[model samples]
Target: MSTALPSAVLGAAAHQARITLVRKYTSAAGVSTVVVSLAVLVLLWFVRDVQLGAAQVGAGGYIFSGFLAFGVIAAAVLGVAGELQAEREDGTLLRAKAVPHGMTGHLVAKLLAAPVDALVPVLPALVGAALLLPDSMPQDVASWVLLVLVFGLGVLTMLPWGAVLGSVFRTMIGLAWAMMSMYALAALSGVFYPVGGWPAPLQWVAQLSPLYWIGVAVRSVLLPEGAAAAEIGGEFRLELALVVLLAWAVAGLFIAPVLLRRMARRQSGSAVQAARERVLAKGY
Candidate 1:
């Protein structure tokens, strides 16, 4: 009975979250996201011939792989951070705080919704890639399997830390700065180019970010063996990539709940109103 009751509560919470997500994605704002994704894909397609490395490998495969990881990171980090900040300002978090186990349910909803958030933007890009750059698509079962595995792991590793980011930055302006830093990391992490060409200290910094490892994992499955010549070590370090991503996932598991609980405990109606006033005052 104890287990069943908890399951039922969680299930109900998840259902509510699903409904909210559906409503969000079905709206005009959701259409804008799809359009933006398609626009980015078109831009990438135009640069498909910009080759990289001594192998002179086509950029299409690398772009597709890197963009795939970018989408996951966007949904897990940017999406979650933005949503939490908005919800907090609008009193949603306060309402959630009023209910029993509400914060847990809220977190569950965000985590579950994140993958879907990623897919919405990614699907259009994927279709565009397949149709426009047919050669970039995974041709074999093993490659496809690896793509899915890396993508799932990417989502798991990033979501909790994303929640932490969202919780830490209480204001929208603060969140925007955080997101810009993440974008800078993405650029340095070889999302669109080779990181091997970067300076030693910068290269080491890029490697510390999971974004770089996610790119490595995605590229391992998408690009040909010869393409590894452009990578940092001139080879696909799949084992190290897996270890790095796993370590981030494990760390996030331990860190996220504690931080989220702390964030929730601090939420109040007055705090929400004060945040709203700040936003109004700053015109952000």
Candidate 2:
């Protein structure tokens, strides 16, 4: 017998699905990863004094940590990959395929969950950075809010790509390689230092990196008045951090769905069996 779901029921179901996904992905292991990453930052703070004027330091501390937001997004990638791989292995995906709106509901739920999972670690890291490094924190409440919004948007931009990666590489070994490459690229892309200081070719490479743009946008809001503004040449106005971030978000939105659809179509029993065997042999 067919029964039509009421609008309210549908909405509630969707909301519940999203919350469940967020909780599933935002586990203790994910929190531990965030803590370790923050610990590294704290050690850095202890090693060298990041001098920004009183106001600048405060803002810089908040903005500078924006790159760490990438870690949160990376978690989303891991979640998607892990979820899909596990489901494929267990034949849960086939069961989901039987539902009327199963695939759409699942993806939407995951998409909603990604940001929450990404932000779970950021809140504590931000608080710790603020309390430990008071001088390098933003004093302005409005600026802090703006920083959060901007940083969140930046993280959102990466989710689609993460989704795409997860869908493509439905195995832990594949995911590990992708994650390592992302981290290596981010490190080399001037997240913590000036890329301009690198060799000319490397500098050019940094220009093409998304991490560079994210770092630049963060520094622009956090750095003091006299410090080199996060500009192309110190003259061009760069109020479009949000815009650049949005551009990436739009690209990901389009590409992710297409990639996921392709992955869904190609899913097979042999692939699932192999994935399960691998997982059982090596726990991710």
The models' CA-based lDDT, in order, is 0.84, 0.64
Q: List the residue pairs that clash in candidate 2.
A: 57-136, 58-136, 58-137, 58-138
> Model 2: runs farther than 4 Å from truth?
1-31, 37-67, 229-232, 235-238, 268-270, 278-284
Cand. 1 TM to true fold = 0.93
Candidate No. with top TM-score: 1
lDDT of 1 by residue, 1-284 (tens): 35343886679777977897889888999878888667768876797777766777677777777778899899998988889888988999899889888777888888778888888887888888877776667898887887888888899999988888988998888999999999998988876566876788988988889999988888887777888877797897988998899999999989988988899999998898898888788876
Could you tell me how far off, in angstroms, the CA of residue 133 lies in candidate 2 after the best superposition? 2.3
Candidate 2, residues 215-271, lDDT tens digits: the string is 766665555544454334542123665676778889888999898778777666776
State residue 103's C-alpha deviation in candidate 2, in Å.
1.6
